[model samples]
Target: MTQLETAMAILMKTFDTYAAADGNKGSLSKGEAKTMLEKELPGLLKAAKNQAEVDKLLGGLDFNGDSEVDFSEFVVLVAALTCACHGRCKK
Candidate 1:
């Protein structure tokens, strides 16, 4: 697979791994989302100015107000972080 293909696969796998943690094979519960962020994106969490900011970030990810993050929502979070880091690296 190409690099982008591999990255996409990894993203799917990562989301599935976390989302399946609590009997939900297709979406992440709040605790699962928090654990995923704390474990997989610790740098992002650490960069947050405060716990409320982290909470806000998580809250915002639930764009549909479903209280659970599905694959699409998870992708948005990854894409946003990737874009943010890309800009930082280009500076």
Candidate 2:
């Protein structure tokens, strides 16, 4: 696979693990997913201005209106972020 594809695959794996463990990305308690993001995503996203913004961004993707972003939603959001960063791997 190409570099971008490989990056995306690794991202998907992270989402899968988070989903299987937490059910919904948003279901992750405050600082939980954020900590993971810090570790895994690194430069992928700008530092969220506040927890509210983080919640809002994640909430926007929670299609079911549940307070959690599911694996699919997380993937979609990460994909957007990847595109925003011009396909560069953040790690």
Candidate 3:
């Protein structure tokens, strides 16, 4: 599988772990992701140019435009960023 696929798998496993730990079940929603980022990775998201910029970036992964990105879609977005960052790191 590709790097993204692998990363996505890892992300799914992570969500599963979170669910298991919390006694909850099912995939994460877009709002949940935004909350998690705000609470857990505040520094990363604080760099966003503005709410619209952040929303646009989020929109790339919000395939359905429901204003909610599923865990799998979130994984894809994260993995894509990770890959890009890794590339820059290697340069």
The residue pairs that clash in candidate 2, if any, are: 26-69
Model 3 weakest lDDT span, ten residues long = 18-27
lDDT (Cα, tens digit) per residue for candidate 1, span 1-91: 9999999999999999999999999999989999999999998888889999988988989999999999999998888888888885342
Q: Model 1: clashing residue pairs?
A: none
Q: For model 3, name the residue pairs that clash.
A: none
List runs of model 3 lying over 4 Å from the truth.
Answer: 1-10, 13-25, 88-91
Deviation (Å) of 21 in candidate 2: 3.0
Query: Whose TM-score is higher: candidate 1's or candidate 3's?
Result: 1
Give lDDT for model 2.
0.64
Model 3 TM-score, all chains together = 0.57
**Cα error of candidate 3 at position 6, Å:** 12
Separately for all candidates shown, the number of backbone clashes (residues 3 or more apart, or on different chains) is 0, 1, 0
